[model samples]
Target: MSLEVKNLSLKIGAKKLLSDINFKLETNEVVAILGPNGAGKSTLFKVLSGEHRHYEGRVILEGKDLKSWKASDVAKLLGVLPQSSALAFPFSVSEVINLGRLPHSTGRVLDHQIITEAMSKADVSHLAGALYPSLSGGEKQRVQLARVLTQIWQKSDLGERYLLLDEPTSALDLPHQHQTLSLARDLAKEGAGVLAILHDLNLAAQYADRIILLSEGLCVAQGDVKTVLTPQQIESLYGIKVTVMSHPEHHYPLVIAS
Candidate 1:
């Protein structure tokens, strides 16, 4: 699904969280929202996911205004993984993943095949029986990913499937972070629009097809990593001095603090 944010602005009391932001996303594209702490990246994700309202602007999904779509209708087309999502009740991994199917299933033959496929894709099949609360941070993240994956896989053929993730790798170790993001890239390649908010510049450069850099509630730079991730822009956005170099094999931008 193509997502277009037009002149988006958000405010809370005395603070402007997002200002005049605009971007367009194409199907099967992986886009990264990158910024330092307090850069409004998460707020942008919330706005895109319809979790936050009372904002001025239009979120268009496949050329239709997002505000006009029903919540369930939107959920069927887009899946979101926020920074921290906790299940109060102790639902098992399988049960949690099954919740993703709620939008499609009407008590018919539950598609266990799809569920299993999602679990395997997320590397959480072993945790299918474990209580969600009992799992570690990374495990829980994977379970949540599995849930979103199941949602997308079930309804992908209906419309453009979009995966919106906010700091999905924050709680994961290095290896798991790579694993999860690689899986996300694979999904994007299979025709899902993946938008992820990431703090790690290296990961963003490695995985994102395009990078949008936000600073002080505005989009400061955006494009391919080589163009958008220059040392000067990085320093201006984060207020930290850094060097941008070429990766040895892939030749994409690589960052190092000066």
Candidate 2:
């Protein structure tokens, strides 16, 4: 029901990418990772998704070590959406979304139902018959999101699932940006752990239940939005002077350039 990372560290050749990172992502919460360029946010994600295993600590999922779980089992439990995905072959958006059903044993009727629901959730249903390669960057991103969502679609069967999103809203428009994060929040509300890597501080503050800020491969601060989005901390992290205030609508901490 929780992802526990303890004393995690990673190195590539002679350079250290992450050092002594620690955090727990529990079900029913959205945690956002924030940092400047080269702050090791992506590296941390690689470790969590089991793509980088040469680290120096433990990643426990549902009371079991991540290394102990089989790759197929992990796939059923965690869904990942990378920053960019490419499709060399011409595949319809619906076809691409159907690929997520590969892991499940559902019948054709059930699969279609799940695919339709996922596309609807991602706001990509209109792009169903469109060729994936012909779509815009934002459109493709949404389709990929639908695929990931479909991968973990049978929420009731997959106990304590997790969604790892790497800048999922980077190519999305204003409304879709909010929509994507809102969907992630909804997933968290459904008792799943959601972890996202975000560049926009305001968006992170608005959607994340907690924030973890990194600098030069080390964790500098981690806590609720109010505690982590302080002006002094943000200024120190991103090297920019900024004003922090309560959002006019939601009253969450809002950051603006000074």
Candidate 3:
């Protein structure tokens, strides 16, 4: 199964945030959305996650329009980690993560087990009892990731599910950045579709199966890493000179500013 966007477009007053955006996210693949600032990446995520629905085209999941799904059904099929989160009550990290399990009716033992596994995968297990609002920015980001991970932890019995992440590594350090993306790769390998908004091209090259590069609210290129992330495309998109070479380790294209 796949999530298909057909000629999708969004506008806010006089500004067009997205224009004729179309792509298919298949199961078990990580698709990274790359672009400079103001490229409409966040707006696209808002459209997909049901926050902004006044778009021009169709977003279909499992052959049905996404807007037609019930709220609980949408929850079952999609997990979203926004760029930032806020907590008002000073909830502990564990409590915040447990909120992801609310849609399911599992027993306490099973819920605890899933929460534990999610925390471990996010590398936030050590912060279990810590109050979420007191944690550092990077720690909070990891905890939020754990929460979303818990939301779509299990595969649906009907069809494939999806995870939408918006700049999930923005506040993370280098090691945690790799760790978070690695967890996303693992989720994709388990038959979940992943769409991540990322600024770091090298990380996208290493982990994403496909790349969608947007500029001025348009998709300029979309394909495998090597095909879409050419030096010419990179330079044109960012208006900067760059050297593109094979990575010394994995042989994927390594983009370095020159």
Per-residue CA lDDT of candidate 3, range 203-228, in tens? 99999999999998899999999999
Q: Which residue pairs overlap in candidate 3's backbone? A: none
TM-score of 2: 0.97
What ranges in model 2 sit over 4 Å off? 156-158
How do all models score by TM-score? Answer: 0.96, 0.97, 0.98
* Residue range 107-214, candidate 2, lDDT tens digits: 999999999999999999999999999999999999999999998876645368899999999999999999999999999998889999999999999999999999
What alpha-carbon RMSD in Å does predicted model 3 have with respect to the real structure?
A: 0.8
- Candidate 3 or 2, higher TM-score: 3
lDDT of 1: 0.89
By TM-score, the best candidate is 3
* Candidate scoring better on TM-score of 1 and 2: 2
Clashes (candidate 3): 0
Sorting all predicted structures by TM-score, with the top scorer first, yields 3, 2, 1
